[model samples]
Target: MAPLTSASDENTHQTLLNTLDIYSAPKPFRNASWKPPQRRNKNTKAILADAARKESSQVTTANSGTSTPAADTAPPNIAQAAQRLDRLVLEKSLIAPGPAVTYTNIEAAPSLRPERTRHYCDVTGLVAPYTDPKTRLRYHNVEVFNLIRTMGSAATEGYLEARGAHTVLK
Candidate 1:
């Protein structure tokens, strides 16, 4: 008879036991389900507000000897919140300048990165790799290039001037 030298035989049974969802408690441990709780996307602030309102309404009704269900109020949607933010900004501006080093939508924007300087097709506004030497208009493909060539010189100059690349000094 040969003694077992393999560790696999000992590990397999223990791993299987750990993986199983045992329904009954054996001795020391209490009966428990290890399954994860279900997930739900909920507005917790509105929930708490509803609960508070319910308690207050219940108290008032009990005192008056009348029973009434508390109406549940839903939280404001994104648009309403945005409008509120805009109003706050307007009010703040009217009152006084904000604290020092304050950053707003139009003010205190970060500078553009030189490494992220990407050209786009003037015609289609897509990522452009090819640049026409005549008008210096960025293009995505040969089709766009042909379109530029057919365009009048004034239009060609317009595209170049718009992008701050002047071919004809005008």
Candidate 2:
């Protein structure tokens, strides 16, 4: 039987790596397709101030006018309208349950930290640290950038040896 060679091994191994979507980075969209939803450019405070001034002027004009308007210049009560909306949107249960109590002991609580896995990807020549989708997820932009930089130089082996290694005893 012939001994396993690293050079020929890497060529076949890389082919399997190329087949997996895990190694591929997401591509940018090609077209300037669609615009986001329309929104008022003016700040909420500014818009409110302008509306208040307009309402005040309307009240002043009405007071100075010869004719007495039937309705007052007061803005519609938004809170009352919101209350009406609450009744319309939300339904209450016929019978209400008693206050619920939950028991939580700090001593018995599990730690928020996650368990770490030490699996490394030597197949792609990624000798340095890389993300494992299963555990220890990394989110930092700098770490992700570093991973991409290091990934290009990662060591890859032939597909047959890689597959055989999994079946063979350590």
Candidate 3:
């Protein structure tokens, strides 16, 4: 039998090209089903601020308050525990200082549904580099998601503070 040659590969190449032309025309725009930012009620904000303040104060007092002479002798143990707790609070404080607040978002998997193609952003439809037959313009879902996630991560403090307050209520 003859070894497979690059010339023979042309047939597969042509077949892929034929298949690609069907998708070459950009997919129609689909309304991106992203959720909008939620509006916080003033009362809710006040309540949350109060709760977070209360919880942190309570935690500080309970963790720091002690009236035992033994506590002075075994100060290392208390100090170690206090140091760990302080470290944790400091870490959380960093997150709580972020500027932008986060709201939950639910995304549907992008799938080929011919009827729904016209509403979404065209950029979402582009195939990844390796998958495309040509090396031209390619759009990666991961890249887009990463960009968005980075923006969200930058707002970590606001997101955590709101989430923290909510968690305390629960």
Candidate 4:
């Protein structure tokens, strides 16, 4: 039996050339006459300064407890409105507010955790039997363990971090 050669395969070469030709062909312009939107001639800094002036005037009038009809009707910024709502809620005892929910609090309890922790080798991505004490990197065999032992501190930390086992100090 003769071994099939790539150079002798005229059909495969022609197919590849045809594929390249199809890709290299000029694509049609979807929006040939399209133009970018025109920009405003206004100065951003001046606009910002004007807005700041208006905000400051409103704040001053509100703080003095002599807000005009226009100032009183204007909606408050999100942070200011949220603070006001919080204060109102606290004053009226609307809801029985408790401790803030966080990642640490929401995580599964120790009693609900799996009995056997699965360990995997960072290098091989296989079931690891041994863990290096210094680097805390799990290894499948002596060869992987030896590789981890010879790695620099940065490389060792990187391997541990990739597996989410790197120890962080305060």
Model 1: colliding residue pairs: none
lDDT of each: 0.67, 0.45, 0.48, 0.70
Residue range 1-170, candidate 3, lDDT tens digits: 43244555767767767776966776567657867779865764576567667766765566553322244455367787787667767755664453322122134234466573232212355444422122122236667545434544334334335434212333
The lDDT leader among the candidates is 4
Which of candidates 1 and 4 is the stronger one according to lDDT? 4
Structural similarity to truth (TM-score) of each candidate: 0.34, 0.21, 0.20, 0.33
Candidate order by decreasing lDDT: 4, 1, 3, 2
What lDDT does candidate 4 reach at residue 80?
76
lDDT of 4 at 70: 45
Tell me the lDDT of model 2 at 152: 33
Q: Check candidate 4 and list the clashing pairs.
A: none
Q: State in Å the error of residue 77, model 1.
A: 44
Ranking by TM-score: 1, 4, 2, 3
- Please give the distance, in angstroms, between residue 82's alpha carbon in candidate 3 and its true position after superposition: 12
Model 3 Cα shift for residue 25 (angstroms):
75
- Per-residue alpha-carbon lDDT of candidate 2 for residues 85-118, written as tens digits (9 for 90 to 100): 5643342221112221223323434567868744
Return the lDDT, model 1, position 77.
86
Poorest stretch of ten by lDDT in candidate 4:
94-103
Residue 167 miss distance in model 2 (angstroms) = 88
